[model samples]
Target chain A: MAVLPNAGADALLMTPTPLADWLVVAPAVLPLLVGAFLIIVRKRLHWQAPVAITTLALVSLASIALLARVWSEGTLVMTMGRWLPPFGISFTVDLLGALFAVANSLIALGCAISASRRVIRSSRRYGYFAFLVLTAAGVNGTFTTGDIFNMYVWFEVFLISSFGLLVVGSTRAQLDGTMKYGVLNLIGTTLFLIATGLLYGIVGTLNMADIMRKLPLIEAAPLMTLATLYLLAFGMKAAAFPVHAWLPASYHTPENATSAYFGGVLTKVGVYALFRVLVMMFPVQLLELQTVVAWVAGSTMMLGALGALAQNDLRRMVGFQVILGVGVMMAGLAIGSAPGLAGGIFYALHSMVAISAAYLLVGVIERRSGSASLNALGGLWKDVPLLGAIAFVLVLSLGGLPPGSGLWPKVMLVQAALEAGRGWLTAAVLVSSLLSVIALGRFFLLTFWRPSSTESRSKHDGTPRVLGVLTVVAIVMGLYPEPFVAAAVRASDGLLDPAAYINAVFGEQG
Target chain B: MKTLIFRTVAPYLTALMLLFSVFILLRGHNEPGGGFIGGLIAASAFAIYGIAFGVPATRRAMWFHPIAIAGTGLLIAALSGLTGLFSGTPLLTGVWTKSPIIGFDISNVIIFDIGVYLVVAGAVSSIALALESTEDNH
Candidate 1:
């Protein structure tokens, strides 16, 4: 049944008891429950793969249902502990949250499928699936949560789980990378906590909806400070510009499955938080800090492309590509217009799938060639036509070319930048895409099209089906982007004008 | 570091601390003590026992992998939150009741607290035992 009627409907028709409120919490809760269960049966290898895949599939289905519900019902709200909105924790599922949650779970589902085939038995015994599910729980929780401090709690959840996932193989390089990843991420987490605390102090509330309502009422100076603190904290977490060093250093250290998952879904959480907090809650402060964001976004784009170009290892190159996607999204954020935010949201949705597909494709190529070094790898096209085809699509997608998912978002962002009269951002968007094409196109040309330099490794029977699914989705979005673009535009509307969200939380409660 | 007097006193000290930890967990809802502190105390008890009697001995006494115990605790805590569903309330809402046998008030909150206790005790003891075992290896 529908939760509520459309917006501007009569308040009297709002039911005190929402029948489907449990749906709001399911995306976060189910994975956590299954993750803990997986830990209990960590010794049993047979149960882990099937159980994790089924749980993620269920989560994806539930998130899709939530997206549908929020699409029709405007915004869905559920408060924990039976308390009112101001005192209780709220799970508000607006269009943006639902969109991201769906994308997050779908990407995770893809990674889980690849991991079941790729991750060895020993790592599975050491709670690999458990860490993956827990990280999913954290990502979904961050996407759905309506409270700022609650968002911080979710950050710590995934940070710890990602640490576990990162160190699964326990190799020396993995340890080193995990250490770099851990210390820097912990610093970012601490900054998030501190910023959250200060925001709570000044506003006396942690709910995002409430903060949005109260922000304009408070003094501007403290709000701007809080905004800067959040920008730094989330910016670092998102791996923007100067603080992006840890990503390329560590993302390649883990198993390819882990790297695919991280590349696909993890950092997007920080971007989502930035959109929710700065764009939604403190619009004025975002406007004030716009120039800083544009600079960070522009430099991150150039450096990320350059870094990708300089990489010898495929995984590290993908890591820099991940950073490049972050820059593109940040460019949209820097524009701070309706279409700009829409562009950011669209790019994030695309990156979540495209980047993971890229990582998985690289994993497959490395498995086939027994090497990830671009200089040593060649001739996948002659060796395996299917693998070459997947790589071609991925290269196009990551390069923001016409035939894949990346094109529309870049178009939206560039158009938005042009409309907003931000020539630098427009140039950044175009230049970044051009450099990305050079880097990724070079990768495709060298690894797939060129003649072989070494003998192939022991060939596996088949790749996971999810890679095809992601590639198809990217192509569909690129070719026919009407629905995705419409959803993004609606999501940006919800973000810019949060009255429906605020109402869903404050207006309807037991 | 395992002195004769310390080893001799450790058993009784561990017992007392375990009992006190339960007491603290039970009184948590109405008083200052709760699962977190109580679990810390219990874990401290295990650490002390491990120091005196050795890691394998402590593991033998527990009869379960510390991580498994932690996982079980997490499951219990998450299930306890579902208790609200039966009463037509939101997830994690405390559902109180009068215990006919015990002649006292109880709730899912207490069950959740016990889950928290097991999680804390299991996780911390695992960490403590790991450190001790690694030290012995050295």
Candidate 2:
């Protein structure tokens, strides 16, 4: 690819650096390579599980290293093909991006372990492992990339792999789910493409930092229009409010491992894109738009919680919880304050781990009981005390109960909203938490607390161990949230002030 | 049920199309022809072969499974990009080297394009084969 000359002389003068910047790209690239390797050897069914698991473990390590490097050294930027800024594709890793990337890899690792025990033999032979690794690469790429168009490409890469993963078995129900999932996501991505094209037309560059730097010079009407397009596109992707119909309709239809992976990482990619574009790229310029997002966030939280309350199926209920988490993140975005954004960021990290673990626990429960319906599952507290305990902790975390990771972020968001005089938002946050508690409590009472009706016993598997680790991680995050909160604060500081990012991307001349 | 005229012409047609696909793949770096279109052409050639003969015959002709071909292509494409890391450049940087025997310039870009071509052809043909075979079962 030819590298186009950037507008500024400073950008033009800077030459591409050496390969030392592999830290930024490796987290994404390593997974892509491993995925390709997996695809090639897919026929070797026996080795597929081990190879995929090992590769994800390595990817997890790389992501952790990337996160550590960024935390210690600030934002890391790498331009592809030795090209300068605003020309070559760049991968920028800030605290938020690195944290999410690390979380995504860990979730993939957990899901890979669970999937080895849970996914059917046929699916494994049909390139399921390949798709899983590809999804990780796409998620990591989406988090790390700095270019808007590159972000769109990463989203497509993510979408295609996830679509394949969703429909791997080609069951009638899976086909139906894939159709809904595919069509809606296609529309969302097309809108994102249009928005990217429009932004390029306006600013003549798709580099996010460049756009932020030039945002002030653009007209408000066009920027606002572009902002609305992005909100619609990413809102659909994040499963926020009106456009969230596809998520609940399709998420529960997939295998539990697939659902857990989607729950853990996919929608969050959309939410991350929303935060990156709407909050970081156009912070002050879109104040009115942010207010609108706040209202959407409130409705999303309320409606999602209500939807969860109405569900008897465990996976569907957890699916609605995912939507509820989106609203919480958006509320933080809506608050447009450092504390609000920090809360949103912290909540995002917390929910990704907790919600995914909940889904995996549901998978374990379904396996044990041979059904996912709450009515069919009973007296698990007596039979499988370990599962019951993990489920309890995950449900409490999902409900934003005290002594869970979920509560700290909610507290921060509520405090931020109240301080900002957004009483309605604060109420919305609290009321949603109450609704979540009711829904989760009902689920807990029916599934774990009630007397058993059948004498079915479940086979012992390694799946719960993966889930147990996740539960421990969540509890640790909940009890000692200082590091995560501090990371969020640092990330929010970056979001609020794009100058540091701009300077890092373009050097001192910026 | 196969027509005599189609059966007689299919082999030559497939051969011509395969040659044309390679031409397209090689010229893709500086011109309009590239991996995606080339792969489509190659897949169409096999599709015609399947229609005239049968799906089993087409699979036999291809030798390797279509998914495996696609996988190999993906591996090649990724490895071509990874080559940049060895040269002290960023990933996916197109590196050119002079062919000592041929005294001509060769580029990793063409290899990457070839990989893409194989992937598209393999993936498309695999889907077509699956659908075609399922029709018999139905």
What's the CA error at residue B11 for candidate 2, in Å?
1.8
lDDT of 2 by residue, B1-138 (tens): 388998999999999998999999877878889999999999999888887878999999999989889988988988888766666667777677766798766777888898999999999999888877786676
lDDT per residue as tens, model 2, A373-468: 987889889888878888888888899986777989998999999988899989999999999999999999988889988886766665478898
Give candidate 1's error at residue B5 in angstroms: 1.1
Model 1 clashing residue pairs (backbone): none
Evaluate every candidate with DockQ and list the scores: 0.49, 0.49
TM-score of each: 0.96, 0.95
Angstrom error at residue A340, model 1 = 0.4
**What local lDDT score does residue A404 receive in model 2, on the 0 to 100 scale?**
75
Query: What C-alpha lDDT do the candidate models reach, one value each?
Result: 0.89, 0.88
| Candidate 2, residue B35: lDDT | 97
- Chain B TM-scores per candidate, in order, are 0.95, 0.93
| CAPRI-style quality class for the chain A–B interface of candidate 2 | acceptable
Fnat per candidate, as a fraction, reads: 0.57, 0.59
Candidate 2: residue pairs that collide: none
